[model samples]
Target: MVPISRLTVIAATVVLIDQWSKQYIQGHMLPGMSIPVLDGIFHITYVLNPGAAFGILENQRMLFIAIALVMLGLTAYFLKHIPEPFRLMRLGLSLLAGGAIGNVIDRVQTGHVVDFFDFRIWPVFNVADIAIVTGVGCVIYTLVFSTFPTGNQENQR
Candidate 1:
């Protein structure tokens, strides 16, 4: 098991980065504003998501906030049991924890998650969104492939 202290550090760092960047973007990128970073592919656009990804359940800020809180609580409870030195799993947890709290901050302050990274082909997103997506992917990979000796590992005694 990796020390909980180290996990706390990682999670804290991710949350800081995620929250700081979101704040910066929110101040600079006005709602419905778009600044092209790479023509035809990427841009920075400010959007407020009151729902989950892809704008699902729009205007359900309370529900989204509740869900994020539950996710963070569960991740915190499960942190100790998660196998250590497992880079992917660590990263996944960091992402999940950081992203959840980051958005929670938004819900408390703005009643929505501030999103700014806009791709022409997809929904606008921010650092928190990136963390969540990548973290979820890492988790799925760990579950499907790595044999870490956690409860999820069937072979673990």
Candidate 2:
């Protein structure tokens, strides 16, 4: 069994870093301001996303908060149930929970998610979004590439 405490640390770390970065962006930049760190490649652009990607379903605060809470709750519950062998999956779930929390925190406080990272070609996002996407990718990789032992095999360890 992987202790929940260990995984909680990972989740908490993500939340802290994510929140800090968002705060930094909010403090140092104004909305729609873009500072090109690498010309034509990357930039730090401040934006308030009031909805999902590309501003879809705009201004749905309550719904977004409810969904985030549900997602966080589910990830926490799953983190407890998964066995130690599935470390990547657990990490992914932890990250997912953290990201969900970070974004939800912004929503609760400002009714918008604070975004900063920009790649010109893609919609601007933040640390929380990075964690969420990376977490999902990790989960998908684990599910596709890692095999779980059958029946009592886990107990035998």
Candidate 3:
């Protein structure tokens, strides 16, 4: 189906971009090195995260791997249920799956996820993190606005 194709394409694209960006960063920057892209605002800082977001549960590589696998499975299951017209949902699911797989690969191979894109305020993150967060935001927006029959509208219907 078109939806499945679209989902696959999106997922593959995200994975490719995420992996490539991480590879580039690893190859160019030394760990703990920081290169300012926009002084006082943005920078690329190399960091190897041994845990989940914000570096929580550090060194729990196995746990993160298990969680990523579970997330990928759930994303696939969720995609199967999303209707064709709900393109945003498909995109969201794809991003989520791709991001999960990206990080999983790092965790499996290196026992750490490569992170950059330092903003100084928030914890440093990478392409996979961006995709995952953006995907979740899209899904949440779709659920809140498109899927739900809002109370007033429901009453009218």
RMSD of each: 3.1, 2.6, 3.4
Q: Which residue runs does candidate 1 get wrong by more than 4 Å?
A: 148-157
lDDT of 2 by residue, 1-157 (tens): 8888888898889899999998888788889999999988999999999998888989999999999998888887888888888999998998898888999999999999999889999999998899899899999999999987788977988
* Per-prediction TM-score to the true structure, in the order listed: 0.87, 0.92, 0.90
- Judged by TM-score, which candidate is best? 2
lDDT of 1 by residue, 55-96 (tens): 888888788888888888888887767766576877788788
lDDT of each: 0.81, 0.91, 0.88
Two-way lDDT contest, 2 vs 3, winner: 2
Full-model lDDT, candidate 2: 0.91
- Per-residue error for 117 in candidate 2, Å, reads 0.4
lDDT tens digits, residue span 31-148, model 3: 9999999998999999999888888999999998988898888888888887776777778888888888889999999999999999999999999898899899889878888954
Top model number, lDDT:
2
What is candidate 3's CA lDDT for residue 86?
74
What are the per-model numbers of colliding residue pairs?
Answer: 0, 0, 0
Model 3 misplaced stretches (Cα beyond 4 Å): 148-157
Candidate 2 residue-wise lDDT at 35: 98
